[model samples]
Target: MRMAKIGLLLDEQAAVDKWAKQENVFAFYIREVLDHLGIPYQNLSKETASLEEIDLLITGLLNESQQALTQLLSFVEEGGTVIHLSDSPKLANWTGYKSVCGGAGYGYTPKELGHRKPVRFLKTNHWYNGEPAGWNAKSGFLVSGSPAGQILSELWTVIQAGNGKIVHCQADIPYSIVGIQQGVEPILHDGEPAPDGTAGIDDGLLKADDGFTLDWSIDRAATETGMKYFSEAHADKWREVLVHKLAELALEKGLTVPFVGRWPEGIEHIATISHDSDFNLEESADITLSLLKECGVYSTWCMIEPGYERPLYERIKQEGHELAFHYNALEAEGGLWSESEFKRQLQDLKSKADLKTVYTNKNHYTRFEGWGELFEWCEKEGIQVDQSRGPSKKGNIGFLFGTCLPYYPIAWHTENNRQYDILELGFLTQDLDHHALADTSVIDPFLEEVKRIGGVAHFLFHQLHFLEQPKVSEAFRKLVKAARANKFEFWTSKQISIWERARRKVKIEGVSASGEPNVSGAVSGANTVIWVPVPKKADLAAEAAEVRYGHLCLKKILSHKQAQTS
Candidate 1:
């Protein structure tokens, strides 16, 4: 077995590279994907045209001289994989595929002019939360039809060349920065068109008729597309394809397969129940708390003005429930706020509610605009997790992040390439919207989806909604019982956050030159996953002394051949 060395071509003369230098969206995204899979990669510079130990070469469209082109072709001829981000004329001609030079993005009709399209896989066309809710788009491709290779995605096509493989992607999966620069417009978050037609942004900020200058950029467009495009779900589409293809290559060369496990301890399914305390109404809180107690589930209660209900807060703490701030009124006046104000409000609530640390929160009304300011303020106030992001509008209530996984929000603006310390737990299903339609059954399908994918079924039940309609309480109790019956592990938001942080810290520390991989780290009481590097023909067995993935709830190992066949 030989070490799998991935070489990333940093083309200085390429336009994409010039754009990435300013934003580094593509490189950053690629690194994120690799990090998620625990695969090590290196940046190949112009001086270093070829690497002796490189197993795979990933680069954008090749615009190099014939000599340089010949070297790459020779590398492929000698058995090496090459993945081109866009249509490569040289590679297409070499591989016997016609590469047409035409601009894309015409005749693609997005179902909704301004909303998120579900992160659908190109091969299976399956979505995480069933029938592709949110938004849809139609885009033309530069390389429409590949004669020999399989089309992994409508935009990404892969072909076997000699002993190697060439994967060419026409669409910008990492189009976060580049798409915006090219004036690629998306629908705003409020289900309205943005000034320049961007998705998932505040309609007020881009108000041109009011004479407000549009301060938006391609970088800002990435920030505004929170749960939509440029998100973890959207990025995972391309990442999964790459990993599957690489695994197949590994199999062909008798190398070990590498992948990132989705859940902690490999648990197949999980649920995190939460209740937002929008109003200081103690009766509704009491009813919901009683229901949770009967169901034997500890939930996170996001409170809005805790000073008004001291006794109830005490009772919640006594009942072993987590207390999180519901900061709405404080941030309601607008997106402007100082850390002092957040600190003062948090301290006042802590002193009144007798809370030790208000580490989590849900913004009142889910107001996340001025998110950059709000998240910075949360860090200053010592908040670790916030579940304020989700679909607030009527038609937008669906899985926005595609999965029920919590993540750290990257601040493209103001943070200078830094992600906020606050982890984002996305809102899945809320009580108000579902209750308005008198349907708690809307969550059933999502739960089923979660079970299949080994994801979290995060539910947001409003205390006021329960008080307004007692039937909602009954619905919740029934749902909890069903979930328990289905073997869903119920978790508090804080517990999930802690487990996520610990799982991310678990990494492969060393890999020998012989291709032996060593992984180490453990999360207390949670299932930790370690990548087992086995030969292509070897049975999936643990190579080193560590926790085996067998103990955890595991999904099927997606092989390259399987991906192509699918």
Candidate 2:
């Protein structure tokens, strides 16, 4: 049997960021765990291929790719399985959909939809191995003309295109939709498992003719009640459900899923630290760097040049560290330094030290109104990467809040009515800059939100924050530990080499499709050529010394020549 290929269609940026914030939660952690288990999966985007190559498709309502939906139906036709989950069944308009609302809190509060009730699995004379049913007296009603209604109304659909099966669950209930492809007789009534390994007539388990059974017996009432009364417990259950379901899905699909890997599991974690200046704060930098180095991690330090201690920057570079400009242009009263000045500053820093990369974090939450200028400068100067996209507002001057994940920046030229000169490497994510230390626990929740949306967790930290207090250090250490324990791979800005290589390959392969300018050749030439700075010296030599006898003989010859001339 060939290994199954599972494709998850989600909002990639949102998912990744969400996962990072909630790394302590099981759902966030399981993403890494599943990847460690080697699940073959990829995030579905506009560029993904057809469903013929995929065996399973797991999607949520938030995943709004029409291409994905079309491919999902095709995969099902190819004898594949589709699992759909959402707060409302109204979202999924695909075929073979049956929704059952109202679960006994199920560890989630069912709002405007209805009241909480116990969810049960029922066996029906249909292709589905198990059908989910809920009993909520308040609003346990089913849609009359919806997908669920169609499935419940028709015994089966003529297997056209392919032998595909879809299992749709409404209201986030627990149930498995496997074994429908195999020919089996469906049980007519709902049943429950016996107390001592026996079967009893209850409304939870469903049996089929071929010894295939669907079990929905995970007890969650206690968890639900706990969540209702205690806030933390509820949060815990939410995480637990997400993690357990993801794991179960991985197992059911029989594929190794990665939480953070190349191609699919995108950018994992981003570290933030302060830069040097008159306010250089050496003690803080020392402590933070020491702890990170001890843990074998290299983080990006956003230094404010001129204010930064040049010696410290040199040391950081020597230690194989990365440096990004913490632009305090406003503080420096640089009066919105021109793009040329910015390029000159960056080049000067590179010349002074063996620096390889740069990121920018403006002082006092400063943002450049015209990012095109900054991006153009970066491209022209071969500054391959940047991450100056923050202050936590919904949007930057013109960019989106979460739009910094290593994409090629598009520059439009108005005169020619065309676009040109894209950046090789772009910003990823930025930290929520409004909070202070210890109060930074909000980072976790923010990371969780990023993970859910498939965004990178770029955290910004000040050296001063961690230096004064061990508590901050401890908190950061715990965060790192949790991230690692959950399988998040640590990377510095330099490691973006992996992303660049992959991106270049993709760009080269689909130049036309990307519609970006073809300046690779020019960029490559500039990077390869070397220029020597020092001038060459002219040769000069002194006459060699001679022995006394040799000197006497030379004088005699010179006298004879002078007499002949006279």
Candidate 3:
């Protein structure tokens, strides 16, 4: 009952029922979180010999196989790890979760902590009345001036059974993350207000920020360091809980887990600065470009219709910056949200480019209508990355889409809700300057969380705001400095897109406990990261090249001969 890596007891039917049966879609978050965490896993739903070679088994959604359940119980009795998600009536005694309905269904939240509890959040953050606008960078970093309380909803029960352990979750964490990341009733949302500056739920115009559950009035929170941040992205932290538990349980069996680093070159974190060239703000391009040059990093320029003049565009490209599209759907700007309209602006922006190639797009005002329409348009436009899913209002910033890192949106139209080809590079805030939320206090804490989870910290600055607005320019400078403080290297969206697409090609072979992966296809030599997870930080001190996301350690693994030399 115990030999190989973690066995993901998947339920194929769950995907089919995701749209009809709300309970089934809860399983979606588990696979998503596992993928994002970069954990080593084997799917047991289809084409598996037996669980005999598996040490830890995570049962997601419904299980129709009773023989597997009997084997699972026996394995647990024999000291194998079994983690039951959603609700499991048979696992009640081991999980310590009481029946919610007069000894019938499983519980929602844990009544009390179990014997073998995992570490809870180090700091509790919340949203209430917070720091007001006009608080400049010099004002302070920590935004704890406001009163708050606990905002996260995850609760767990862990019990030391037989020779192993049983971990249970009653709140349905995966479902929550999926709901937050995707949306609860985005497609059906109509009456919801445009509080985030995006369209209302009923607007029928699907912007990337559609169906957001994080309330601007309540969900915004600061880091434990005191810097303000979007409390919405806390889902990433919740997902990380599984990463720790996986490694902790595996270590008890004297095994180590391997994972891929979020970035190459052994870097702990990444940052991206983008400028939306609204109405071709060429007048402010020099100042914005100069600021980027002073920071010693390239950026992405998302251009709207009638882009910068050929000369300025040439300079931007010559400087090695990425030139992308900023699709305009604002009616006042004489824009439309139709597919034909999107294609029109895309073609127009591409024509304005020197290279005639646009790989990325961040919609004008982050306009989105449906779940898959924007992604589908991007796919058709040959765009590989998009930054449209973010908050336009200052208060609505920070992981509003439930992640700061780039991810492929799950295509709900598909039977399996398949991941799309385009990468969604969700930005934290647009126009961090603007002379209003002029403070850079939120930068560090956001970076701290990004570093902790191996995620990207992306910021958007409109070119026009860099010059006329003195505080806006100053805010940009402070942001770049704060990024440097966190040791986060700045990259353009193009670089991120290329790296992500390339990173997926890297394959890990030889899946035994020895756990040395025969990796290949790392295009960026010396920069590609291959991570290994040990129980302790000191596990691979001398040989370990770099530490990465989750408990995974070890360093950059060279996949080719050139990589070894470079």
Model 3's TM-score against the true structure: 0.79
Number of the top candidate by lDDT? 3
Q: lDDT for every model?
A: 0.54, 0.37, 0.63
Off by over 4 Å in 1: 1-3, 7-27, 40-50, 58-78, 86-155, 159-165, 176-190, 193-238, 306-311, 329-344, 354-356, 413-418, 432-438, 509-517, 531-566
Model 2 lDDT per residue over 1-566, tens place = 12335665544443444445631111122222223222345566342445666666655423335654565666777777655543223333344433443312222222221212322222221222243342332212222232233223121112233676654443332121111111112234443333433223242322121122222133211122121000011222222233333433334443322221222222334433333332557777677668878877777665655534668777776776677655443423563446756766666666554566554323323334332455566566655555543322211111122222333433322211112232222221222232321133444544453344233445555566566556666666766675566455566655554443332321111112112111221112112111111111211123111111001001011121222232
lDDT of 2 at 387: 54
lDDT of 1: 0.54
Measured by TM-score, how close is model 1 to the native structure? 0.69
For model 1, state the Cα shift of residue 259 in Å.
3.1
Off by over 4 Å in 3: 1-4, 17-26, 46-49, 65-79, 88-154, 159-165, 187-210, 215-218, 222-232, 354-357, 413-415, 436-438, 510-517, 537-541, 545-566
Report the poorest 10 consecutive residues by lDDT, candidate 2: 549-558
How large is the C-alpha RMSD of every model relative to the true structure? 10.4, 25.4, 8.6
lDDT of 1 by residue, 370-430 (tens): 3356678888877889887664543334444444556555554233334567777766557
